[model samples]
Target: MTALHPPGARERHALVVRGGWDGHQPVETTDAFIPFLEDHGFDVRVEESTAVYADERVMGGIDLIVQVNTMSTIEDEEFAGLQRAVLNGTGMGGWHGGIADSYRNNADYLHMIGGQFAHHASKPPEERTGGQSDNYIPYTVHITELGTTHPITAGVDDFELVTEQYWVLSDEYNDVLATTTQEARPFDAWNRPVTAPAIWIRQWGKGRIFVSAPGHRLEVVQNPSVRTIIERGLLWAAR
Candidate 1:
């Protein structure tokens, strides 16, 4: 008979957590990923405090962070710890406008990710951010050839989805994975040739980043294609 080795003492991960915006169900969204990491050899510890940004003690010893909160302020020390954690090889990943559009009051975080949520261009000049838009708009995402050759998306092909077609003002540093274009509707103007990045990956110091623009609802989080992208992204980002 062959003997199996027991798990090691060092097989653990540190997670710094904080987020709000009930629209995204920040708590559930963050928790959804815990099982996946734990199953993949990571001992996950979650800081459930929404004030994790102020708790100096909670920052060190964590291996990665999954942020799901939207629209909050962050202090310098908290930002520093996260910065150090990633620079030391920890990984970070998040989706939708939550993580990417988080901390409306902090400029540093926006600079770290390389973009901010500009005005949602999904609407017309009348209400701008307030009007209702259609769902199941039926969008097609084009997978960049470079993305198909990359680890997180390698072997993945073009797929279609029904969700918010996020039109983002992107940072130049990101390695874009997929993009979708929209035709101008009477309610909005997509007449230009600009493409919206559906998924992207980036780096911050030694840390890694994966961002997805499609998780506008719980159903999207459960979609097979979205799940595949997220699972692969988490592993690829983790050290």
Candidate 2:
């Protein structure tokens, strides 16, 4: 069967950005997001830039950006440039800890991303010191009321998956697209209940942003439904 985002459709464009620590799986992870655009006709460009910060020209000529950078901090100029690029309507998308957990030490980038990774809403804190892992587990996703009628989640259901299910503390400003009802975790000291944003789309300046809190591994992203979420996310996030 043909890929989801075939390149024969039209002239949609995207930039696949990959760079960061190896443990977070940047190179392989971003590749997972590229073919969807390629299969749908977006002329995709891949930049395996370890120095996306130093090169400076990586974001040039791109209409959309799909970032797979994880647990890495960028210089002010580099981060700001990419933020400006996306804010100017070039589009941006990512999942899990990459965009949300990126630059934990930097507030500007955190503000740009709109949320921080407080903790894995599902996992018990006693299970590990830091909630960082590439484990592939299955879980269900609950669509929210905000943008459920939108094109992105139009066909997606409250489906289950054997993959990472991200629970993010999102900004109230986001146009929430979907969510998951995380069961109450008594193990969590901050404890009450855990229900978090599974996916969200935000508008910045002249551009758009979409984020999904899943895809811890390549296999997780390879799922047809997961692929669909990323594909529609790209189309929706793109200017």
Candidate 3:
């Protein structure tokens, strides 16, 4: 086993806790950004359990937390400790369910993060020349006028992507950077279009919070625009 922080000249400390439902490819998804973080001067510590959040000694020293776990349970102590760390200026960031959909029963976690994954908009199966995938829909993300000036989305153009269109339950507190629209489908009765945040930032006391609704799939996370947004978000969120 490796110590949380190995002896070296590492400037920043990042703890990546990845575990939970594998449908999201937690390990593989987190792997995509590990190299990028390391190359950018962070000593990354990867763990497969949420217990790391309970270690106050370790949590206190961490400069950032990159979680990839989805729909997992976290104890109160663990959640509290994690919250304290972020409140004290340790940055927290993640994508998809890792941060948004995680700990569905924990309201503190949700409030701190400023949003929760409500559901993915359902799309009717498409009739194509070949075949179609279930629950996956194609949509375009529009960078908000505000996003054009935010460091995380600056210079990044609106782009089209094929994945789950996450309809997040967000609040006014979030500094929304980007958004996507969900058009009404035959099966659903909303009868109108709804727009949701695709990327956002929040503040927890002295800490910085960043969340991107991409990363449902490795391919989505690998998209040039998506990846760039995530990379910049991480850097911006780090303490």
Candidate 4:
């Protein structure tokens, strides 16, 4: 991994807030990258709750925020502090349900992130075995023309994955980097094929935000291309 800041530059601070659903393996997944952050010259601080977001002292000095809480609720004051921090130039980044599927009831949070996880289409009943694997389908992440030049995705090619292909709800404000298509098979209800953003970046106020829809687990996060994008994204999003 390359160091982000030049020698002699002020040290950067990174706050990793991870908790909520364990199915996504928040702790393990976030742990996989903490060293990378530290290696890139960040002073890393780890927190297990969103409560830290409400602390102005902590949020005020944070250069980046890596959130991994999924399907969890956020307090009004906590979210307000997070909003203020990001708007004031603290960057944020995360993957899969950690960021996109978090705070399901907070529309403003979704607005700031620029996307939400709608659903992951599952296999037909006849083909299904049991559990979450029913939703795991092989799909290709296609890099866009713009992605060919974007700092986070340049040089990365389309790649295939046999995992949960996320069907996301996103806005035009996002700078889409890569996408995955959910096919309309005979067993599926959707009429036409839909392509959702697989990876993207957004600028909210003075802060930069990066999100990748592919990291459903540690193994997925460790995938070569996915890992490369995320590593680059973390640095790119930092203030």
Candidate 5:
């Protein structure tokens, strides 16, 4: 897909805040995007902490904020500055636990993110063998009708992947782009089906927010389809 901003346009600044639980590979996953963002004409700045958000001038100057911190706490002042920045039109985007499952205790943060991780379906501990890894599940993600025409998802076909399928607590405010079906699993045995949004975008004040729920593993992030969706989403969310 073509970039939303043409070459030779003024450079857009992007800030990537990464750090929290190491299990999320915050640094590694976020590092994968620095070059991509730079190649797309963004002046990228990566920080290992949210302290940058406390500086109003810095936050105000940024065009996009890609946060990859998982399960971390944000100071009141820092979060307030971020809130003001986005409200003033700094776009925000991230995937999986980075954005969706972060700052668990911060209700205001969750409100801006539009969703929070509920759980990942996994086999009951008792049913698992030693060293078994049953948390990963294979699933298919279908692009919604709206996605067919949405800039971030246009021309992207439905794809299959095996990863941690997250069931999130989401709001109707999100413009859902794609979805996955959660069928009965031994982890939470029940004869029913539930649908969860796999990719979505929304507006907060003048800013745009984009999220994808399939980036738990490096392979997932490296997948052609997933990478394309995210790359486009970043551009779409930029100011």
Candidate 6:
């Protein structure tokens, strides 16, 4: 529980925009960290729509934006304001589909975030339980050499999770911190194994962007390793 802002530091504001497909449990997931942000000295504000992204006066004062909306549409004006805020140095961060799989039609959003959720490798048909759990595969999240030294991932050891393993489409602009490799099993289509970034950060103008692909639910968000990385990432990304 290290304080992000020391005593005497100016008060900072954090905006949490949450909603969209409920399957991702966006509300619950973001709720898990609001207290953390408050404890760290942020004046936390919660919004249920992406409309707030369009409020320039509000966006301008924000120190950080934690978006938890999944598979939702954003108005062009809203998207523009968000882009402007980040470009001017307001940090942004989120986990799982809340950030990665959001605004599917917005290429600019994808380019800004530096990654998109391509797919979630599923279990074989016989093993499927006929629900979202079908993609709950046990896998390891390997900390890269760079992750070991980055503030967001420093000292966090490689860990395992039984959850949706995201196949992310990302570019070199991302400073990858952690990765997960999808094995080429007999049932899978790809012949060779594919590795996707499980966690990463990017510099967008003066703002910093942090993303973690492992938080598919509240339980996953509460994982010690996952929780720690996200907390540190939030502070590290803040303006």
Estimate every model's Cα lDDT from 0 to 1.
0.70, 0.71, 0.89, 0.94, 0.88, 0.94
- Cα lDDT of model 6 by residue, 72-110, tens digit: 999999999999999999999999999999999899999
Candidate 6 TM-score, C-alpha based: 0.97
Candidate 1 at 61: error in angstroms?
Answer: 1.3
Write the number of the candidate with greater TM-score, choosing between 1 and 5. Answer: 5
Give per-model CA RMSD: 4.1, 3.5, 4.1, 1.4, 2.5, 1.4
What does candidate 2 score in Cα RMSD to the true structure? 3.5
Local accuracy of candidate 4 as per-residue lDDT tens digits, 11-93: 89999999989999999999999999988899999999999999999999999999999999999999999999999999999
How does candidate 1 score on lDDT? 0.70
**Candidate 1 per-residue lDDT over residues 9-71, each given as its tens digit:** 356574747456677666676677677777666767766554564454655555667777677
In order of appearance, the predictions have TM-scores of 0.84, 0.82, 0.92, 0.97, 0.93, 0.97
lDDT of 1 at 103: 75
Alpha-carbon error at 71 in model 4, in Å?
A: 0.1
CA lDDT, candidate 6, residue 143: 99
Report lDDT (Cα) of residue 126, candidate 4.
Answer: 89
Mark the regions of model 4 whose C-alpha exceeds 4 Å error after superposition. Answer: 1-5
lDDT of 3: 0.89
Report the lDDT tens digits of candidate 3 across residue range 1-239.
Answer: 33333466568999999988887888998999988888777889999998988999999999989998999999999998999999999999999988899998888899999888887865564542332245578899999999999999999999998888889999999999999999987877689999999999999999999999988878889999999999999989999
Residue 169's lDDT within candidate 5 is 87
Ranking by lDDT: 4, 6, 3, 5, 2, 1
Candidate with more favorable, higher lDDT: 3 or 5: 3
The runs of at least 3 residues in candidate 6 whose Cα sits more than 4 Å from the true structure, single-residue gaps closed, are 1-4
